[model samples]
Target: MAGQLSTNSTDHAHALARQVRKLRETRGWSREHLAIEAGISLSTLARLESQSVAQPGFFTVGAVAEALNVSLDDLFRSTRTNPGLWSAGYEGRDIDSFVASLLDHGIDMVADVRLTPISRKPGFSKSRLGEALSQAGIQYTHLRALGNPKDNRAPFWDGRVNVGQARFRDILRSAEAQSDLNRLTEQAVQSRVAVLCFEKDEERCHRKVVLDTVRERIVVEVQSLS
Candidate 1:
């Protein structure tokens, strides 16, 4: 019975891995993007997808489901039999374009990591943006804690400001930042979440700092959508 149980578990893990790969491929997403979205370590995702891990934990599996915007049951079922799931990170374009992009990518949640959620852009301000997203059946959350400190951000500015990877590395060492990152990870584990900020170029934005920090602890694939 013990041997049989072990064998069953292994089979289940392999099946789940296959399903994960299929869903990712169907949406033209890379492993890195899926890992970031799922808020799991890239190494963990690699092992799970490669069937190197005999049994991934329940929470891990559930996180992957949430990132993919599917239920736990869906992960175990045949991909053809389950609803298609997709998610991607997006920079806020015009309200109309931004909302359209979210809908286009099947993103249901947006994690705004901007220091200030207020935007001069029409319909992109916190209140208006939330209403717009709600009407489109998408959820919006502002993670102000994830924003880089104003002092830290100054060094990155030039003709065009860039997010200093080294500076971000130092900021993430703080307990407070780690706590906020933990919260963001939890959110990502619950649904299809996009990390949002003002800068259209992800490299130029501090939102990338948050994403990179999360990537260190959990394997995740990240993409920049302008």
Candidate 2:
């Protein structure tokens, strides 16, 4: 009987861990964000999600539940699983339309891959965009390391080289770029993540290069929202 009880307890812990992770992902929250929202130490939330604690304390659980805006009973309920990856550009989109497109496609997070997160368009600057996404309940993260250097991209724009033959793939072979690509893939595995840029067309954007590089490492479904 004791052995059976122990097994059940372990199963419950695992289930709780999965549920917590799913809930966090659904809201596009990083562990740090959730920890802050829950008013708990980051390490405690990490341990709880990792199932290092066989049984979390009531107050700890209550804090998490409150932060997630769900009751204890609701926390245990299963959620719809995340789909693979999606991509979007803000070429002609206003902030409202841009966010609406993301919502239409069930995107939980926006991964900005611009080297310089500035734009002539209103509300597209890094700080403003982040605030807008937060208001829309979508998480926004900027991965500048994945952006193509202007020097490298300039030749293609000047017609010295065809855009199709720009050798952008070579950039992905760099150690730093690979590391950022891996990080983006890990985030996508946890939630519905989209690569964001300003080009209205995927073919014209460096984000496609980043997306293709990621695909070589992991299986992903690609969608373009321009």
Off by over 4 Å in 2: 1-79, 155-166
lDDT of 1 at 139: 54
Q: Tens-digit lDDT track for model 2 on 1-226?
A: 0001123334455456656765787899999999999999999998887767978888998899999999987775542445567878898889988887776565666888888899999999999988776555456777767887787776545554445335667766778777777778876666667798887777667787788777877887777874
Candidate 1 vs. true structure, TM-score = 0.56
128: Cα error in model 2, Å? 0.3
Q: Residues 143-221, candidate 1, lDDT per residue (tens digit)?
A: 6667777777665555335446677777777787777678666544444457777766666767766776667766565
Identify the runs in model 1 with alpha carbons over 4 angstroms from their true place: 1-92, 159-163
Using TM-score as the measure, the top candidate is 2
Give the CA lDDT, 0 to 100, for residue 47 in model 1: 82
